[model samples]
Target: MALEYDLVIIGATAAARVAAIEAVNLQARVALILPHPANGQVHPQSDFYPYALAQIAKTIQTNRGQIQSPSSYPWKYAYTAIDRLEQESSPALLAAMGVDTIFGTGEFCRRPHLAFNINQRYLRARAYLIATGSVSDYPIIPGIQSAGYLTLDRLPSLVEREIPLRWAIIGAESIGVELAQTLAKLGCQVKLIVETEQILPYEDLDFANLIQAQLEADGVRVYLATIVTKVSQENRSKLVVMGDESIDVDEIFIALPDRPFIEPFNLAGVGIDHTDKGISIDNKLRTSHPQIYACGNVCGNVLGGYHSQSLTQYEAKIVVHNALNWRKIKVDYSSYDRLPWAVYTDPPLARVGMTIGAATNSPRRDLIILQKYLKTCPQAILNNITSGFCQIVVTRTGQILGAEIVGQNAPELIQILALAIQQKLKITDLTTFPCLSPSYTEFIYQAAQEWHTYNRNQKQQRQNGWLNCLCWWK
Candidate 1:
C-alpha cells in the first residue's frame, strides 16, 4: 500500500506551519516536507536582525554623552537573540497536532504517474501548497564572490569577531538604510552607496526623505545614484569602486531582496513557470497546475514588502481552507488594503494602506490630502522629539483612503490607521474619536478636525458667491 495524504505542504516556514495546523483541524491528513534547517530549510533572521540592531542603535543614540549601563559591543545582540526555523516549525508541535513532518526537500516527479519524492520517501496528495519562502540574494559585482561578504546567516559569527571599525553598504533599500544607521551609531565609519535615486524607491517620498535626512545627520556618507562596478580585497580591506569613488572598508554588506526558493522542484519540468521575483500564482494563490497552490514569499510579486510575514500568515489561512475543502476560498489581501510596515530606524518610518504616491496617482481625482507636522503635535512637543509628520489621503467627503507617518511611535499609530481603514472610517469619523489631552493619537483626530473646519469655511465662502469672487463683480 502506498502512503498518501489529503494535502502535502512544501517548506517548513510560517505558511507551512499554519497550513498544517489548519489541515488537522479540518480532519485532513497532511504531511509537511522540509529540508533540515542546518541544510537549507532555515528562514534566517535576515529581516529581524536589522530591527534588533535598530533598537540598540536607538538606545545608543538616546544615551549618548550620558552616563548609562554600557554594553561595549551592542551590535552583538542582533546575533544572539533570534527565533530559529526549527523552533518555529517544531516537529513535536506538528506531532501533537497530528501532522506528519518529514525532514528533507521534496520535488515533483514526472515519471510513474507524477508523485513527490522527498529524498527516498514518496508522497502523493490530493492537493499541494508550496510555501518554501525566499533566500538572500547577494549583489553581482566584479570579484564579489572572491572578496567575500557577510549575510544575515553569518551575523552570529560576526559576534565572535572584533567589532568592525569601518563598513560599506552597497544598496539603500530598507535593509541597507537600517544597517547603515545602526552601524554608524555603534561607532563604525559607514559609507552607503546607493543604486536608486531615492533612498526607498518603493515608499512614499516624504517618509523616505525623512529617513535619509536622519541617516546623514547620524554621520553616514550616503552616495546616491551610483552602482558598484567592482569589488576587490586589497591589504586586509574591502575595496568598493563606484563611479568616480573608491571606498576601502573593513567590511562590505550587500542588502538585497530575497529570491524565491524553487530549485528543488525543477519547476519548468513540471510546466510551472516563474520569474526572478518568485513563483507565479494567481490572486486565488493557485499555480498553473490546478491542484497546486502557493503562499508566502514563494508567490513573488503578489506580496511586495521587505517583511511580508503578516501577509503570509493571512495567505496560509486561505490556502488551507481552499486546498482541502470542496469549495475553494479566494485569498483576499484587500480587506484592509493597508500594508502597515515599519523600517525600524531610530525614529522608524511606518505607513499603512495606500501611500501619498498611490493616492495622488489613483484615478480618484477628488482625493484631499491632510497633513499634521510632528512639531505641532502635543505629544511630540512634550517628548521633545518633533522631527516627522503624519499625512492622510481623504475623499472630499472625508473617506479615509491612506495614511503615512514618521517618527517615534509611528508603528503604533499606523496600527490605529490600519483598523480605521479596515472599518472604512472617514476623516470626519476620526475627528469624532476621543483622544487623550496629551497623546500621540491626538494627531489623527486633530488633523481631521482641522481639515473639516477648513473645508466647511471654503464651502461657505463658495456659497456666498458674489461677495467672495472678482468674477461676479466683472
Candidate 2:
C-alpha cells in the first residue's frame, strides 16, 4: 500500500513543527517524521522542560503571582513558554486545519519528494521539508572516544547524573559556557578551556571580556588561548592534556562546534548540493530542486554557533510561505545583519548586529562605535551587578548599525535592539522613545545619547579638517 500526503516534513524540530502547522492552515495533509524522539533540539530527553517549569512555578508561588494555575506549567513549559502553548493548543489547532503526524526518518525516494521510513514501512508525500536541523560535531582528539564525552544532545540526559566535584569543559561556545555555569551552580568545580584568546570569540571583545569576568567570578577556571592535545582516563578521572599542562577532572566535556546533519539523508540522489556547513539553498529556501525546500540549520546560510531558536522560527516562516505559494519569494535575511543571540550563562552575553572588528573592517569606515559600562548604569549600581557593558554602532546618519550587551538579562534586553535594527530605527529615536527609567532598558537610550555625543565630535573634526584644507589652498 502507498501512503501519501500533501506535505511531509522530514524533521520534528522547531522548524518542522512550524512548517507542519502552516501547511495544515493551507489545508494540506501533513506528516511530520523524526528518526528519534520528537522533543525540540535543546531538550531531547524532555527532562529539562519539567525542571525549568517547576522552577518557574516555585518563583511564581513565592511572589504570590496569580497569572495562571500551577498545573498549567508542564514539562514542555520548562523548554519554552511558547512550547507550552503549542502543546496545549497546536494539536487541536492543526487538526482543525487538517494536518496529521507521522513518526519516522525520511529518505529521498526521488527529487522534490521523500519516502519516510517509519516502523519498517514507507510513506510518501508530494512535497517535503528538509528541516532535520544540525548536529554537533565532537573533536576527534586521541583517546577522546575511549575517555567518553557528551555532546549537546547528551547533556540533558546527564542532568540526572551526579556531577562530580571537578569538571573540565573544553570550548567556550554557548553550550560549553551554559553547561559550565549550570554544573558550577550545582556544586561542581568547572574549568573551561578554549583555543581562542577569549570566550565567545564571535562576540565583541568587550562583551567577551565581560563574560570571562562573570565566569571567573562564578568560580569557573577559564583557560584562554589553550588547546586540547589529548584526552585520557587516569585514576578513575578524565585527564585533559593541554600542551604541557595536564588537569584531572571527574567529568570532561568537549564542547566542540557543530556541522550540518545532512550526511545520512543522501542528498546526492536528489540533486541537492551540500558542504560541511549544510545543504545549498537559495535565498528563497529552495534547494537545487526547486520544489524541495529547506530551512533551519540544514541550510548553510545560518551561522552555526550564533543562531537562536527565534531566528530559526523566523526562517521557517519564510520557507513555509514560499513553499505554499510556489511563487518565488526572496527571503530577506537582513534580520541577521543585526541578529540578536544570547549566551545563557550567568551574566549572559547578548548581541545584535556588527562588532567593532567587523565595523572597522567593513567598507563603511564612517561608522561610529560607542560603549557604556554597566558599572555606570544606575540600575546595575542599585542591584550591585556591574560586570558587563553595553555597546552600540551607528552610521553618520544616526542609524543603528549594531548593539551588544553582556550582563544580567542581556538576552532579554537585546530583543529591543534587534527590533530597532530590523526597523532601521535611528539612534536618536531610541533616546526619545518612552521607556521605564531605573531599568536595564534605559541603557539603550543612554547608549544612543553617547552615540550622539560621539557623532557631534566627529562632525566637528570633519569641519575643522575642511577649514584647514581651505586655508592651505588660500
Candidate 3:
C-alpha cells in the first residue's frame, strides 16, 4: 500500500529538516526523505567549523602575533566542539519531534499520479519540496582530478591531521577566503587565486577590498585576475600552474561555485522545470508544478547571493506556511530588499540591500550617504582594532535603502539596519535608540547622527532664503 502525507520533503539537507519541523508545527503530516543515509539515519554536517576556526585563529593572531607553527592552537578541539553541536539536528531528534524520517534515495513518478518511489514504497503528498542543497562545481582545469584536491566539504577531515605547510586555494569564494585567512593565521603559507578582478564579485568593491587587504595582512598571497591553467603533482608537493608562472604547495583546495543537487530526483520525467543552476520557482516559490515547491540552495537565485543558513531557514518558513495554509504568504526578503548575510572573516564583512553604486542610480534623487569609521568609536579605539567602517544609504527624508559594514561584530551590527529597513524606520530613529556604552553598535549611532545634522542644515538654509526674499520685497 502507498503512504500519504501533507508534504514530502526530498533530501536530508538542513533546509529539508526545517521544512519538515515547520510542517509538523502547522499540524500537517510530513515525511522527510533522506537521499543517502547510513543505518537508516542521517547525520547533519556543521557549517560552523570554518567560522569557529577563523575566530580561534584570530584570537591566536591577536595575542601571539605571528604564529611560527600551525600547532600553536588546538585544532582538534575545535572540530570536536563542532561535532558536539550536531545532535540538535540528528534524525532521532527529528523523529522525536513527530517527523516521519525515511532513509533512502527517491524519485518522482507520474504514471497514475505524482508520487515519490523509494525502497519499494510510494509516497504521495498534497505538496512536495525539493531541498537537496548544493555541491561544489569544479572548474575545467587539466590534471586537477589526477592531482587530487580538497573541497570545503572534505576540509573538516584535515583537522585530525597536521595542517599543510603550504596551500594553493583555487577560488576566492567566501568559504575559500575564510579558510585562507584561518590557515595563514595558523602559520601556513596560503596562495589565493582569483579569476575576477576582485575577490567577492557580488559584494561592493570597497567591502571586497577591505577583506582582501586583511587577507594579505594575515600573510595570504593573493593573485587577483588570475586563473589556474593546470595542476600537477611534483614529488610530495602539488604544482599549481598559472600560465608561465607556477607555484608548488603542499596541498591544493578547490572553492568554486555550488550547483544544486537535483539530478537524482528525476524531475524531467515528472515534468518539473529546472536548470544547471537549480529548480525554477515563482515569487511563491512554487515549482513548475503548482503542488511542488523548492527552497534553499536548490532554488538557486531565489535569494540572490545571500545563500546563508539563516536565509534558507527563512525560506523554509515561507514554504511551510504556504504549503499548509489556505492563504499563501509570498517570500519577501525583509519587505524591500535582500536579507543581510555575512562572511566570517577577521574583521568580518556584512552587507544588505543596495550598494552605494546601486543606491546612487536609484529613483530617489535625494539620497543621503552616511558613513562613519570604527576608528572614531571608543570601543574600537580601546580594543586597538579600528580598521573598519559603517556606510548606510538613505533618502533625504531618512528612508534607508541599503548598508555596508566592516568592523567588530559587523555581522551583529548589520542586523540592526536590516530590521530598520524592513520596518521602514528613519535615520532619526537610530540616533535616539539607546545603546550600551562602549559597544560596537555606537558606530551605527554615529552614522545616523550625520543624517540628523544634514537635515538641520538643510532646514536652516531654507529659512535663510525665505528671509532674504522678505527683505527684497520690503
Mark the 10 consecutive residues where model 2 has the least summed lDDT.
61-70
Using lDDT as the measure, which candidate wins? 3
Better of 2 and 3 by TM-score: 3
lDDT of 1 at 123: 84
Model 3, span 336-357: residue lDDT tens = 3648878888888887777876
lDDT of each: 0.77, 0.70, 0.82
Using lDDT, rank the candidates from best to worst.
3, 1, 2
Off by over 4 Å in 3: 37-45, 61-69, 72-74, 302-304, 333-338, 361-363, 456-474
> What is the clash count of model 3?
0
> lDDT, candidate 3, residue 415?
93
Runs of candidate 2 exceeding 4 Å displacement: 37-97, 111-114, 120-122, 363-365, 455-474
Q: What are the TM-scores, per candidate, against the unseen true structure? A: 0.90, 0.83, 0.91
Cα lDDT tens digits, model 2, 1-474, are 457777777775667777887777777778766655322253222323323533443334221222221233232344465356446435455555566665454567562345655665566766677887766675778988889877666644443444356788888666787767655544457799999988888776766776677678666789999989989999788899999999998777767766666765668876888888788888888888766788887675544256466667787777777876757678777666667777766666777788777886888767887888887777888899857778788887788888778776787888888899988888888889777768888777777789668868978999999999999999
Clashes of each: 1, 1, 0
Instruction: For model 1, name the residue pairs that clash.
Output: 338-353
